[model samples]
Target: MDHALIEASLGELTAANSRELERKCEQIALSYIAQLVEPQFDVDSADFARDPRLICADRYWNLRFQAAPTLATAVDCAGWMAEHVVAAVQDPIREKWAMGYAFITRNSVESAAEIADATADVVAADDSACNKAYFAALYHAGKLRANFFYDELEIFLAASPLALAAGPHRESVLFTALRAFAAFGSRTTVHQHGCALLDQMWNSAERTFAATDVVLNGLAAGKDFDGRAQLLRDRSAEAVAAYPGRDILHFRLATGRWMCGEYDAAMADIDEALRLLPAIGWRVSHELLQGQYLARRDAIEAARAADRQARIDRDRVQSTEREVDRLAGEVRGTVLRAVELVTVFAAVIAFAVGSLNVSLNGNITLADRIWIVVTQGVGLLLFAFLILGGSWFIADRLARRSERRDRPED
Candidate 1:
């Protein structure tokens, strides 16, 4: 982001003749647009980031508003700060988290302020300050570029207006916090800052707001995919708990749970988001959140249908594999049975040949020899029949047993 255009535009605004200055803020507005369309830098480079939105500084805003709040001076002061104050900038204000944060922050301040008005209702530390001083301070904060988490916020606001009217020699604390939270920073510092920002609901005027994306994105950037998911999920859940029934909060929470890695849980969250979407907030239909959410619903439903089919296919494959294993077992058993039968027959033949040799070697009559041959032949035939009949009987019994199991009994 070559912010030379911002300084140059501010200078141009000062030099414009009365008539031209009164016409429009075309140059200042266009300068911001041009920066937005600038070509992106490499990710590893120090300058590689979407530029933060410009904001008005707190300096001298009190004095200006004290006289009379005019639109012209407000624009002039904003331009002046962009030139002089390093920046009172924040990340762009479009995240669901940021939008939801804005909605909740606005309500939280109002609710807390109301309690502060009533002596008996104040319980929590954040809302316990019932003094007019606290209300006055909060009023000032809301009126002119509220930094809800400024260090020594009370003392700074209590200080004399003239003392607050100094040129900023360094970056505004908000920009510093945003920069640290967004890009790479010390792990411990980023975590501490992110958690602190999460705790405090932010309220800013339309032009002067800090984007919660600075914290949300920074926290996510510090971690890997699953860690990022869990962190966002927990944070969004906390927000939902604090302010229940906000549709945007539910939408953000589901997306955070997140990113479809935990399929079933993520799917459930998406369904809830789709169910809770509101039916309004349209200026141009194209810009409406409802349109965007409808498109998202279509995509999520498609993903869910695909997820269902994938599980069905997986189950079918598992079932087929089990059947294959059973068939393989039967084939293995048959092969083992055949090998055993062959081995037994071979042993019986060897013994019969040995006995015949022994009988022939002994001195004996021709008749004796005939009798021995007949007996031996008969014995061999009987042994063969018995062995084959035993194998057949065993196979028949096994088939019957299997058939019985396969057919359900009446």
Candidate 2:
């Protein structure tokens, strides 16, 4: 029961269609029976009645072609089918997932729930294979939990003797793969939520086993739920006592500390895990957790930058407004002063020509005529300058207003 081997097999099963995966499962189980310890008891025809996989497969195959594959219809068919298979066989979890895959692809959450519920009970009853399937079912439940009628998934963390004896070295790998699958779904809004639960369940399971390098790395990176990080730290201490100079549990313990928001402790764990990870291919879970840590760090930095920019923009706007007000006030005073000067000049020119009767007679000297003419000419030029200056000021103001109106709001 190498968790890694089973994980690889499950990967094949997941990617394959229902029928194909089922066939592969049957072949593997049969091969294991053939090669492993020989059977002592007889498998009777009546015992076949107790064998549920055969019964389930027979029933589901018929249901597939008969109906339009509604959620209810799929469940009804798959439930009865899976029960019979598990009842007759010692471990039918893998076969059940294959059945679930069929129903899931057809959008039958009910059928998957039926099998998942059954698998949970087996896990509680101490079936090692059931534990694996329980996590798998949790993932399916998350993926297809929309229907209220579907049963809820319950994850059992206690160790079973059958499971402990089956694959001492491999369960972690299985845990890793299933967790990745569950996480893949949970990453999206529309997918499964069983990922975190599965991670928790496996973390509990890992505590009962001998600590390995891969397991330690996962713990150090905080791959499990928050509550379990402390447990991993304690477990890592045990690993150190049993296998001194090993980097496996030390890194995991550090990761647990990190996940618990102890950055300094996490850094220490990372340093140790890095020392050991090179011995084995770095675990995928550790890599993903590292990515998550980096992503959060980036998000925090971005938020700080945005806050700083907002303050700068606010100050700039206030300064610009004050400058505009000061310029507007100066322009207004200058315009009013110009109007008053033009009025005074007009009155003076009229008084000189009319009331004073200062005439430039044709028989008078040229210097007198030139002085009178120059005075009138200067008055005319000053009036024209005032008129053009006012027009230019109005035009410039309108142009600025138009530009502001055309600009996009922030």
Q: Can you tell me which runs of candidate 1 are displaced by over 4 Å? A: 1-181, 184-226, 258-260, 274-277, 281-287, 363-410
Give the number of the best model, judged by TM-score: 1
Report RMSD for candidate 1. 17.8
Residues 1-410 of candidate 1 have per-residue lDDT tens digits of 55565444434544544345423233444443445332111111111011222211121232343333332233333334333433222122112212222222232232333323432222222321222222222233332222333222323333523113212311233333343342323332434554454434233232112333334434444534335577677766765676565555555566665453454565566566556654322112223445545655565567767878998997787667657655755874685478557756764785578567757766877777777767776777677667766766776676566556555468
* lDDT of each residue in 1-410, candidate 2, tens digit only: 35346435644554555556555645544443445421122221222122323322333333342333332333333343334334354233333332333333434433544554544444454334433443344334333322211222112112322223224322443334333333333323222243343345445633323213333433333234535557556656666676565444555555455545555555555565556543221123335444544454444345446656887997798678667766775676677577667666775666466424545365656777677667776766677677657756875786577457545599
Q: Please report how far candidate 1 places residue 91 from its true position, in Å.
A: 18
lDDT of 2 at 228: 59
Clashes of 1: 0
Question: Which stretches of candidate 2 lie above 4 Å from their native place?
Answer: 1-120, 124-127, 130-132, 147-357, 360-369, 407-410
Q: lDDT for every model?
A: 0.42, 0.44
Task: State the displacement of the C-alpha of residue 45, model 2, in Å, after optimal TM-score superposition.
Answer: 29
Q: What is the lDDT of residue 347 in candidate 1?
A: 49
Could you tell me every candidate's TM-score relative to the true structure? Answer: 0.41, 0.28
